[model samples]
Target: MATIYDVARLADVSAKTVSRVLNGDGPVGARTREAVQDAMAKLGYVPSNAARTMRSNRSGLVGLITGAITGAQESARPFGLPDLLIVQGIQRVMASRDMTLMIADTGGRADRVPHLVRTFLEHRAEGLIYVAEYHQQIRLPQVPDATPLVLVNCFDDAQSPAVLPDDRQGQHALVRRLVAAGHRRIAYLTLRADMEATPLRTAGYQDALAEAGLPFDPAIVRIGYQSDEEGEMQLLWDAIDDLLRLPEPPTVLCCGNDAMAMRVYGILRSRGVRVPDDMSVAGYDNHRIIAETLYPPLTTVELPYAAMGMKAADRLMSLIAGQGREEPAPTLVTGPVLWRDSVVERRAATLQSISL
Candidate 1:
């Protein structure tokens, strides 16, 4: 393998000049920098990261921990894959700074985190990011005071710096748009009642209805599923039947995610209900696989998984640079609602409640 000395000789410069160009530490003439790069490319020369780290007295390594599996799972959730997407986002940002990213998948085991953390610290990771499969709460073992640690899609009572999706805001925006489009009697088919996003999204739905002077009809709200089990599809179908049976059926059905929305599409088609012509639909988490596949593509909100990952890395880097806030409040990233062919403008009279 070609060394820095060989590159310097080919470029007609000193090894220190090659180092300067590689590390971007000190300025070299633009011509000299170009020549060095060309020479290195010609020789397929790769810089030694270990040598660079040792010289700088910093690891230049960031550690990421997640509960997501590397392969297909028997119990994977529908819609977005926050863990994998977040890691990809983090890696993208770190690569721009010439930092190495080390990832550890715990295989859905929380008990493995502490061991992973210790191993990362042993390798002198400059920072750490802990990501969860979804937005939830968690507790972790004590980390060294000096190490910069950030949480993504999860939080603890300790109020450590965290980055999360603004689910409530995203839902609120979606609902508000629907309301503005003259949709009054909107049905909400929710996800698992126990998940943190469930209540937050419900609140957003209620907020939009209240703002639009629409009555909050409990009958139109249905808990579609408690988990991503195949058995839950039956419950969703039952909820749809219940909603359609109402005296004044909803003009639109807002689903928890695109996967659920796709299921709704199949059920509605089976009943001869043309989407946007007879009933409209909207969903969250713009999982392209589900959202874009429906006859008329599903309108939904982006989950902002990658955005949260990038933001978490920014915060981690801030802490590493000794610029952390006095009180590190949770940072929220909101995704814009994606408009598609699934929904349509409705007449005001079509949204009125029917007499019992």
Candidate 2:
């Protein structure tokens, strides 16, 4: 209940001195600062955040909206949750700046985003970040001119600033590594045909093959995954069967993600196929739980989710600081390829060209 004035009186200093010490707006003598602190501790006084925000003319709040499922709901999507990591990244940067983050989960509903954004604006949030479940495009309602908005893992038709994974580069690097390891006949089991990553990654796959002087064969690449759809086991088996049945069966199978890789592990074992022996496997999104737990740890690429979150926050903060109104260009973050036990060196004996 003790006010700043009371602390000042007790410390034998002017209220202005106390205000300076509390806000750090101006320098106070070391002795004066110590005395002020001593008095505050004795009086059990706490500075009012509301008053500080009012004086500074800032809400000290950053708004974040995500379409992520948490806790029990997380079971619905076991692939790995990058949105959760992205939120953690954003919170880390915000905390360092002495700012508070206000988060809202849409539970996979994009329709609720505009309403949520409006509510944050009403609360005087200085900046806003929108996070999607994956790298995809979205359409958002109009935002005020003064507010700075940034997108994470998604972009909009309005050209809002965005931070996204460099799927092409990541996949390119992975495929190049596979080729270096003597994987001449590599097969890619792709994700949903509609998602942005599917095609970009496919392009990367081709780029590597072209560079390696390896022929690009359409039959080796197949649509292997989809979102919110069942019957994945059938699709995966069909893809695997097609790849292995080819007279020139691939030595390596590249999967869309670690979850798929996990499924592939089971499928290959069921068929009496040995990993890194009869076949080598790789995946994207080095999701540790899925990747590391497999019999032979998975060789995969990082999704750079945390890095994307940091970049988006930095961009939003820059915009808020009056750095020129940047024409929002999508900023891309690259993922590194992780080599692990799931891949084995191809020997000359296993490199024979089989006739179909």
Candidate 3:
């Protein structure tokens, strides 16, 4: 129940000075600032966010809308990497700026977003961030009176500022690496057609193949719903069977994500297929579990999830400062490929058909 007055009295400074330090409106002497901070810390002072909103008409809070924590029946926890990492990054930046975060869960239901936005607005949240369960098209809720908003990992054709991993770049980088290592017949295991990220990644894969002058064969690509790791394993096994039966089976397999790559490893091991010898594998989204658990560490792309969160927070802060929202174009962030033991060089094919 410590108030600014109590802190000022204890620190022997005026309440206005304390307020200035708290709000960062005007500069205070270092010694005075330190004294006030120490006194506030000793008194366990907590600012009333509600009162601040009432007085300033700004909550200084950013609302983050996420998908429900629990995954659907067969779906693995959607948006795991982007959700965790992006939040971490956002928190890091917000801490530095002395801001607060509010969260809402949509559970893969688009209808829930408007309610969440209204709640955030009711609470006087200064800005909003809409995060999706997966890389899918988003129909965003209209912010009341043009409230500042940003989308995370979801793009709306109507135009909205967003932060998401550059799947196309990541995919091309992955394939280019594998191709240079001598993998000509690279197989791509991807998610179903409904997902936007799937197509972007698929396009990148095709671009890589075309650049390498490798014939694009529909048979080498397998697409299925990504429900859970166990279910994906079954689908992956079936896909592997189909691929292995081909006259020219791929030596390297590029998966859509780390989870799928893990399943690929399990299926390959069960069938006595040597990793990086008989076949190599790579994937996007460097999930912590997959990176550390596999016998041979996975070579995957590290999505800048935390960075995305941090950037979103920064942009939201700008909006809250009355700077206005940026144009409604999603910002693409590129993730770097993490080289690991999962891929090996193909020494046999020195000269092959190179695409223009």
State which candidate has the highest TM-score.
2
Compared with the true structure, what per-residue lDDT tens digits does model 3 show for residues 155-267? 78767777777888889888888888777788998877777888888898889889999889999999744566567667888899999999989888888788778777888
Order of all candidates by TM-score, from best down to worst? 2, 1, 3
Q: Tell me which of candidates 1 and 2 scores higher on TM-score.
A: 2
Could you tell me the TM-score of candidate 1?
A: 0.84
TM-score, one value per model: 0.84, 0.90, 0.81
Model 1: clashing residue pairs?
Answer: none
Highest-lDDT candidate: 2
lDDT of 2: 0.88
lDDT score for residue 352 of model 2: 59
Better of 1 and 3 by lDDT: 1
Candidate 3 scores a C-alpha RMSD against the true structure in Å of 4.6
In the predicted model 3, the residue pairs found to clash are 74-227, 75-227, 85-306, 86-305, 160-328, 181-346
lDDT of each: 0.87, 0.88, 0.79
